[model samples]
Target chain A: MSNLAGWGHYPIVATECLPERGPVDIAGLVSAHPSMIARGHGRAYGDAAIGQPFTLPTLGLNRLRSFDAATGLLRVEAGVSIAEVLATFVPRGYFLAVVPGTKFVTVGGAIAADVHGKNHHRDGGFADSVEAFRLVTPGAETVTCSRTVNKELFAATTGGMGLTGVIVEATLRLRAIETGWLKQQTHIAADLDAAIAALEATAASTYSVAWIDCLARGNALGRSLIYAAEHASAQEFELLSNGRTAFPPARSARLAPPLVAPSWLLNRASVGAFNALYFGRGVARAGAPELVHWDTYFFPLDAIGHWNRIYGRRGFVQHQCVIPLETARGVLAEILDRVARRGSVSFLAVLKQLGPSHGLMSFPMRGYTLAMDFPMTDTLLPFLDEIDALVADAGGRLYLAKDARQSRATFEAGYPGLAAFRELRCHTGADRHFASHLSARLGI
Target chain B: MSDQKTVLILGGSSDIGYATALRYAEGGWRVWLAARDLASAQRNADDVTARSGQPVTVHALDVLQSEKFVDFVAQMPALPDTVISVIGELGDQKRAETDSSYAAMIMRTNFEAPSQLLDIFAGRFQARGTGTIVGVSSVAGDRGRGSNYFYGAAKAGFSQYLSGLRNRMSLAGKVRVVTVKPGFVRTRMTAHLKLPASLTVTPDRVASDIYGAAEENGREVIYVAKRFWLVMTIICLLPEPLFKRLKL
Candidate 1:
């Protein structure tokens, strides 16, 4: 057994990991290990993919099955990562319809989490682009699930957190683009009211996201800089350029922390200072339209490889929650206030607007979602519990994909569809065969 | 048109051979995996076909059967543009020291069989006027060692044959030959040995080096890790008296 952790690298768990090489291997593993969970890239940030005795790792099964240039439909193994997809297809005038903040996430993990991106408000979650998928169930049967076939299984498996089955292969409908660049505009908001106003003002943009200064207090509380963008069309490039433009060549990560940083280096003072400088820089770039590469605009954190090491050996927790649009500003302001009051500084704080949730356990709602990362400490669990209570009161759900320490009561209160999900799981016999640390802890 | 490149891999059941097959397949080359065990080669061919989305076929060919070698070449559907011979046996040193037959078998497996096969291909490739040949030798062949001198001697003979082939192929201008010398590699052959992680390289590394050598025109010899060239050079420079006195 080896110790494996999620992208957060927090709460490391010891489990026997099965390295699955292909579809046959995945089916064999499911039959051999009664208790197992399929882990894809381990980007879920918590215990959802962690299981005892067996964590089926799908990295080895990555392969491109087929592609139709005309329809833009691509079939790939579940283990193929977003990074690989972007590298292979972007230059060919295609892009993933939905992409999470990190490109390192595998297609299966993204589906399991039903991950959202900046364009979620416009294009919906990752599952919206998936046409069909092949899943290996607990009984070692490979079944095809899609909207037309096995509709209920389709809903349950997507955002099911690997509880229903192991996703072996998936077919995705890719979006065609003129170029791999975005025409971006930034808006600086001084306080909670201005941030809400900014989000409302830029609702027309196809892609929009906000970087909040979580430590800002008093009049400056909930200060944020919003980024709004859309793909640069060929006509726009023609008008702007001399008719000689080429797609931006994808750049690989060139920098990575060779070793873990000292924990004390990420304390309140240092993080606060960095937040100030970042906000100031964003404000300086406000109102100017800049053409930026999609990789740089969508996945800024990816430029620095092994960035989790910056949080030190103890790792960190990312608490993300979405509240109704009406109470979004008030709930987010209070959440930030509580985090500031606790002096638990977060190095990265992001706020994004989400459209309607697609699956039974999809994290998004037609509202605002705020995600923040805080280094692990003795006071973190209690602080999170308080935040969870406030979110529950506001009728918001804590994202299961990002939860490491959520209580069973909190989970029950958050997901109203839990009963239906459980019924489906029971009907499919997943309750008896499939289980994860999060499932067992939440009493699902 | 670029996807029409064909590469034939002998001893395709070996870890290094399978890795090379996958590498070539990924490069848009149709691959033929020829090994003694048809089942194992077919499995590897299937893996490459899946991973690279390229065509791969398996054929049965036992290198020990010299009489069948001619028929093996005749039976192939089409001659490959490039051929890679990755056949070797790391025979038991202790057994070789005690039994002369074991030493002869070691020489036969590592040297005679592969060179005889290559001797046939060398003529066909020269006549075709456009082909690349890669033979994987070993760094142990640089200088004789008491531990595995029989294996070393066989590899040394193989390397000498490669050097002559490289010279002959270079004169033809269209044909090229490359000799690959890999350091300590962590394959099934050395799985039981407690090899230092720092010193032991993976089969993937060796495969990439071989692929790289073929990519460049008229590239003669490749030390898998470039640093091995320097190490082997220094070891060869040591006086015979000093080298014989020290145990390697």
Candidate 2:
């Protein structure tokens, strides 16, 4: 037995973690353990990937089964990470149709969370790019799920929090690109309303995201820097690379912080000062349309390895929710105000626009999503409850991938499809075999 | 096709074996991965081929079955340019001291089986007049201690065999033998132990060191982290009276 935690490092649990090096015998494992949950890279920021007694880590099952160059379709084992895919195919002029903020996450985790990216408004969630997947069911039978085969399972498994089964392999559609570069345009928004307007205006771009200053108050409340980008063509890349048209070479991380930061080091004042400098730098370079590598444009935080250590040993919780478009602007402003009033320091805050959801329990919808990270501290859990009530009233739903604590009532209120999902689980006998901390907490 | 190099890894399912296969594949060599578990070897072979865009084949070879060694060599598609044996078992020392069967299994896994397999490859290489052989040994072989002398003794015997092979191959002036002594590698075999972080290195580090040694001629023996050489030198030269008195 060993202690394990999600990426947030909060709610650490002591469990028997089975690391497999070959094709997993899911049926055997399920029959042997009282209860278990399948985990991939443990990238989910909360309890969604942890179990009470058993956690099956699929990092060892990584392998690429096949690839079709003519059709740009690739089949890979669930343990294959987005970073691995990028490393192998980027120079070959292909990219994943959807990629989350970090490339460190595995394909299985992305499918389980139905992760969305900066291109969500244009490309939809990860389910849009997935064509099929092989799942080892609770009954120990391997079944292929897709639009035409095991259709119901396909709908429920994506974004089902790994309750449906253990995903083993997936076939994904890859987007062809001329070069691994993006032409990015930055827009500086002085306040909450301006930020929303900028995101709405650039809805046509292939990718768009905003970095907000959560501590800024009054007239500067919700001040943000919005980045809109499109894939750079070969000619555009050549113009920037001294007539060279080759893809960007992979580079190692520049910095890896210590294992843990001192508890007293990340208070409100220190975080506020860092935000001020970051916002100022963004404002200074707001106008020019620059050609930047994909790594710099999409995964800026990845450059600092183990960045979660900045939140200290107690770890942190990320509060991410999406409100309907009709009430997004008002709800966003209220959320920013409530956070500022509480004087809780959130070091990183992100805002993005999403298109319609693809899976039964997918997080994305036609609305605006806001994500903020708060270091674990006394008086923070109750404060988050207040925010949860506000979101429920606005008919908004919290992202399970980022949730560590939330009332069962709040979860049911947001997901109207919960009853259908539960019914399927009961029919498949998944309710008795597959489980996680998040599943138990939400009474799924 | 003639210009492409080929390598055969004997324990391809092991962490160090898989990593070395990937390193050689990245260097544009066709890799043959052999393991007792055919399923695991195939998976690793597919992964190496996918990641490096190089061809990889899988074969089954159970080192414990000494009688099958001849047939296993004959079945290979061709004699590879290099053959690396990374097969060993770190059996429980306490159990081995009391159980003769367990102690004998450890001895055969670490010393006898590997030596027999390498002897076959060495004979073929000698006849071919040009080949490289790498044997992965452990730093524990430098000295025996009360904590794990069973595994250490087997490894020490294996290291001696490799040194003798190197001496014999040098006279031929065609075949090369390299011995690798890894101090503390963070692999599944050592996952249960709480090793000091400063002394432990990743399997990838050992894989690259092996690749570098095979590519450069006349590089006979090396330590994975290089620092282990100095550390082992002191341990090997220590006075036996004082060494036996201190607990490792």
Using DockQ as the measure, which candidate wins? 2
- Name the 10 consecutive residues with the lowest summed lDDT in model 2 chain A: A19-28
- Global CA lDDT of candidate 2, please? 0.88
List where candidate 2 sits over 4 angstroms from the true fold. Answer: A1-4, A12-22, A242-245, A262-264, B98-102, B245-248
lDDT of 1 by residue, A317-390 (tens): 99999998888878888998888777778978898889997788888888999999988888888989999988
For this target, which candidate reaches the highest lDDT against the unseen true structure?
2
Instruction: Give each prediction's DockQ, rounded to 2 decimals.
Output: 0.20, 0.50
Model 2, residue pairs in steric clash: none
Docking class for model 1 is: incorrect
For model 1, how big is the CA root-mean-square deviation? Answer: 4.4
TM of chain B, each: 0.95, 0.97
Candidate 1 lDDT score at position B239: 94
lDDT, candidate 2, A147-233, per-residue tens: 999999999999998888888899999999999999899999999999999999989999999999999889999999999998899
Shift in Å, residue A442, candidate 2? 1.4
Error of 2 at A328 (Å): 1.5
